[model samples]
Target: MVVLPMKEGDFIKIEYDAFVKETDQLMDTTHEEVAKEHDLYNERATYGPMSVVVGSGTLIKGLEEALKDAEVGKEIEVEIPPKDAFGDRDPKLIEVFPMNRILSLPEFRKGDQYPAEGMEIRINNRTGVISRIFAGRVRVDFNNRWAGRTLVYKFKVTELIEDRDDRMRALISSVYPHSEEFSFEFGDEDAVDIILPDIVKLDTNWAMAKFKLISDLRKYMDLRTIRLIEVYMKREEEEEHDHGSEHSHEHDDKAPAEKGSEGEKKGEEPSENKEASTDGEEKADEKKE
Candidate 1:
């Protein structure tokens, strides 16, 4: 079989481990075991091969350039300079603020005495980390964490996504890591229907993820129309719970009436229970519907 060269717009899956050359610190990795060994495990992160569209600029300049010359299933190691990786640290990016000013920020208003060193904070819509705190002053460094450091990446391109549907799925997964839970149906006229999982609708970042997915799909796939369908169906357990709750209230309401009827049968005066039996019935019916 002839192997085609990877080019721009080609979708591929890659697994990599990146490190800072100076300290040999593992900056990032796609392998869970490697991250754990390096004490960089993040429970919230998804560990596995990551999908990428070549030359998309989603990756750093150096890595993207290196991927162009990479072969699928062959592990390659490359050293990237500060210029090609996160750019060299700039002295101008460092700023010192008065301790009072730092304390007055909204994030620090929770009765904290002062910003701790290494604490990340946002000011003027820019994120920075506190590098130092001294007498009446706090230094915030806005440089990228890995700035001025040489990066080493050991990576392999696992698979090239050539099928149209598979390409679409990879693109979607790039935006939302949980794309496996979504359903896709391609139609004529370059239109595709994406049936979103119910869980995604509740995510705070779902809107932003959707916007990026649409932008990528249009830019890469050249699709004309995209439809995101969200289906909300009541589960049988939920329906049963609602019905059970309504019946429970109804039973409670009848108990008092039944007791009153029994008292009357014994020729005793009926107790005056002023509470309305239909009070919660309307609310329960509304909830069920």
Candidate 2:
């Protein structure tokens, strides 16, 4: 069978295992068992085939260029240099900052201590890693982690996406990475409903990214309506339980009023009996006169 080469703007699904060439360290993989075997399973990360638009800059330049003419179903290995992968490390990217300055940020101020080494933090919208901790100052490196390393990626193209819904999903991945687990529902009026994973829902940047993705998707696809599906866990369900409990408590508080009304009815019954007894006594007195 002859296979056509992947071209630009092609939506393709690929499973990959990426490594650092120098140390052969496993950087990332899309297989679950591989991650578990290597003790690299991160509960937060999704494991599966990743979708990408070829030549869309969604992937690193080297990988994108390598896949431009690659065949589907066949595994391919490519080595990407730092320049093509993450850019060469620059000494100017390293800087020192006072611990007090870092602690002044909202994300750090509420913490008990400065972040430990290798911890990534953002301050004033710039992301940096803590390289060293000192008495009153710390060293931060703003360079990308793979900036100076060559990346070796072994990947197999799984399939080419042709369906409009599938294509929209592939394009949405650029905005919301790690959303391979999302499912889709088609509706009338050319509408699509995207059911997102719980992890993506919890992302702090989801709100802002969602609006941007909506706009971008509207421009990219011909759909008339797009909706997000939110699946809540125990905590969100607990909120409903809380509301019900609150209503129950209010009913309990109003119980005394109900009892008061009953007490008034009890009091009126005795007064009626007393009035009947008095009328009977007056009739007897009139008969005797």
Candidate with the greatest TM-score versus the true structure: 1
lDDT of 1 by residue, 73-163 (tens): 8888999999999999999999999988888899779985558999999987899999999999999999998999999999988988889
Root-mean-square deviation per candidate: 14.1, 6.4
Q: Rate the local accuracy (lDDT) of all candidates.
A: 0.88, 0.83
Top lDDT: which candidate number?
1
- Model 1 CA deviation exceeding 4 Å by range: 1-4, 104-114, 202-204, 235-238, 241-289
Q: Which ten residues in a row have the lowest lDDT in candidate 2?
A: 1-10
Q: How accurate is candidate 2 locally (lDDT)?
A: 0.83
Alpha carbon deviation, residue 79, candidate 1 (Å): 0.7
lDDT of 2 by residue, 1-289 (tens): 2275777667788898989999998888999998888889998777788887776676889888788657778889999999899999999999999988878877777776557899998876789998998998988999997889999999888888889878877777767766567788878756889888887766898887788678766655656799898886678679999999999999999999999999999989999999999999999999999
* lDDT at position 185, candidate 1: 92
Question: Where does candidate 2 stray beyond 4 Å?
Answer: 103-114, 177-204, 211-289
Error of 1 at 87 (Å): 1.5
Error of 1 at 169 (Å): 2.0
